[model samples]
Target: MSLDSSQLSTAHSGKTDLVCYPTSHHILFWVNTVSYILPPIMTTNGNDRTTQWKTTIIVSTSLQNHDTSRMLLAQHHRIRFSDAVKSGSIVFPQSGIAFLIINPQELPENLEEAGLFDKIKKFVTVHRNSFLLLQAPFYGKKELDIMSVIQHRFLGSNLRVLPVRNNTEIVKGMLTIAKATSKPHVDSMRDRMSLARAHIIESSSVWEMLRDIKLG
Candidate 1:
């Protein structure tokens, strides 16, 4: 799905802290480039200590490629990487707001697929605090259909799925997530509620559009 104006506009505001990208070598290049453009830190309690705030970018993939994935990301000093094995083992920070990128190719054929679903469920459970970002597959429509199903499941878990069409959209989505998660404690609840409502509306619209296209 293409990113709407609101999504694109957010990138310029420098709001997101943690962002995850696909494990592909091509995506790794862009993810590394984007990480250099760090978002501005919002002052907390009127303090000017900028060193306390940090943005972490992570690369995620399956365990079969864990060694290669780490090697690919090793050159990028600012980016961290992790892989989720079928055994439900995943390595990621325990706490903090994160923008998780889910490449359609890296996911199971469908969310209902047994063993893979369990692994995914465990991964999501561990990073329940994250904002999931679903990127369209580099392939075509069939892959997108599968991605849509995965997107819906994440939404059901109360996690917002930010859709992106391209690399630019990915950056924008990350910033948008950062902005939402970085709100003050007093405003955080309201922000989350608003975001949840938006996701519900957006997801419903996307599915409806998909059904219409399929029928047509």
Candidate 2:
């Protein structure tokens, strides 16, 4: 089935015609005959929960006219443009996270010649918690090479790499990550996790055996 923003809205609201199958921590949903795995914000009852998380996105002035920025605005996210941020960068201030969006097609064939490493180094230095959003239509050799180089160079740094196919994926990735890392929501997730852990311990046969042995 074809998926659009409206379909995403319904899916996010836990009301969708599409059948979703959970795989570990992600949910697999089919769109346009292609399956996509999305990490759902799950509640205590195992229901996918979202729509309550919202935060302002600080966009660089260079991306003011970009499709990614427009898509975020269309999704009803509050966007504030600033010149202080690096060009093609977006900041989630509440989460202390920043993302530098780069188009793989625009990158030079010789990465070192383009000084890509220096640019990324500056970006990481500016934002302690940062991500590199590498946009590519497909994960061809070029894309993989770029991702591999960045991952190798940034090892042990406060930087992560997210590969996005389109503007839709970009927005989805950003929102999902920002919501999970932001305030109040992160705390709530911790509480739910603790409860889940307690439930597991209470229901475990090993725990019961240990208790019986101790009592005996």
- lDDT by residue for model 1 over 103-207, one digit each (tens)? 665665545664544545666676656555555636477666865666666555735455556555554444334433443521543343334334443565655
> Which candidate has the highest lDDT of all?
2
Model 1, residue pairs in steric clash: 16-178
Candidate 2 per-residue lDDT over residues 125-216, each given as its tens digit? 99998889898878999889989989999998978787878887777777766776678776754444334334444565766888889899
TM-score: model 2 vs. ground truth: 0.70
TM-score of each: 0.41, 0.70
What global local distance difference test value does model 2 have? 0.73
What lDDT score is found at residue 216 in candidate 1?
A: 100
- Top candidate on TM-score is 2
